[model samples]
Target: MLNYGILSTASICARYIAGVRESKNGFVYGIASRNLENAKQFAKKHNIEHYYGSYSECIEDENIDIIYIPTMNAIHYRWAKYALECHKHVIVEKPFVLLKEQAIELFELSKKNHCFLMEAQKSVFLPTTLKLKELLDTKIIGDIKYINLSAGFPGRFPEGHWMTDHASGGGALYGSCTYTVEFLSFLFDEPSYQYDAHFIKGKGSADDVVHFTLLFNDIIVSSVISMCCALKNEAIFYGTKGYIVVKNFWKSNGLDVHIDGNMTHFDFPYTSEFVYENNHIQECIEKGLTESPVMNKEKTIYAVKIVEDLYKQM
Candidate 1:
């Protein structure tokens, strides 16, 4: 079994641990934090076997076959690079890195080290998302002319939290829009043809709202992401024939397809939305693959580039 070491005590780590337990070929072997006590508590609470005070110690542990980095957006590149250099397979959370160059550099380092590396984008590995892609490929909704994705919630972060700090990779674009960009890349099997974006920042805060439009040849895609407001939180693909609606698109377990005034609903219930991605990672490791065929390097680089360009416009 692949022994997984997690790099944070963030709330998401709990969910990731649950998913790893549900996975077929992996387990949470350890957890690490900047504080030794925090690491110990997290390890005990999650039933992890090992705990380390420093990230370096965790990555250096020979027993850990994979290191999962769920740290902040800005530091993902640093820890991922460190783990890769240590010859450990790495899984980095979404918004892989702040810059496209960082993404390229990390992938190159992974290759040089002969280690597996993937951005942990659970949305694309979700069953609902896979079904959506299948439907699009089969033209179940005819030709898709336009796509609309809206994701947001009234998120309240504590004062000085990284989520509201632009330098720390805070803001709606890094936090939520990454989901839309990576999701589209996965569905279309290509990045957007071209794109433009607009941002809204509150006083002394990062961009709280973002509206972006992308063109994929004949198809037009529009998206709005926010941390300061509530949205419908769904994705709609408008086709020549009809449209498909995916509720909670980021962690969706079901979707509804509308065609000919008929609506068909599909559900794929799961205990943990992250299990699929965890299983995929193990499968790749077992196959001696250095990169995921689905969430490959090119898609990651393209997604990061899209965000980078949007940030440049900000």
Candidate 2:
């Protein structure tokens, strides 16, 4: 079985631990935090075998086959680099790194170390998402002409929270926009056409709202991501014949298809959305693969490049 080392005590880590438990080939073995007490408390609460006061200690532990980093966005590069240098397979949460250069360097480092590495994008591995892709490929909606996606949640970060700090890679662009961009990249291959983006910055220096448009051949794709207010949180694929509506597209378990004035709903229920992603990681490691074929380096770099370009404009 693969032993996973968790590198943070953040709330997301708890959810991740729960998901890992559901995976067939892996389990959380250790947890680390900046504070010794926090580490101990988290490990105890989660029933993990080991706890470290520092991240380096957890990475260095001989039993840890993989290091999962779910820290603040700005610090992801540092910890992932360190983990790769230690020759441990690594999994980093979304918005993998703030800059595209960092992602390139990390992949190179992972290759050099002969260790597996992947960005933790659970959406693409989801059963519902895979089914949606299959339906699109079969031309259920006929020739695709336009696509619209929006995701948003009310901003409720506490004072001084990382989500509100630009330096910490806080904002809708990094926190949420990456999802839509990466999801599009997965559904359709790397975009070859032109694209443009606009941002609206709120009280913090980071962008709270973002609107971007992409041209995929003759098909036009538009997306809006916001943290200031709640949106419909849906994705609609407009085609020459009809359209498909995916509610809560990011982690959705069902979608609706509209054709000939008829609507059909499909459901792919799951106990934990993270289980599929974890299983994929385990399968790659078992096969001694250094990178995921589905969420490959090329796809990751392309997604980051798009986001990086948008950030440059802002």
Which regions in candidate 2 have their CA more than 4 angstroms from the true location? none
lDDT of each structure?
0.91, 0.89
Q: Which lDDT tens digits does candidate 2 get at residues 54-162?
A: 9999999999999999999999999999999999999999889988999999999999999999999988889988988898889988999999999887756655678
- Which digits, one per residue and each the tens of the lDDT, describe model 1 over residues 181-217? 7888889877556889999985546888999998985
CA deviation > 4 Å runs, candidate 1: none
| Clash-forming residue pairs, model 1 | none
Give RMSD to native, each candidate.
1.2, 1.2
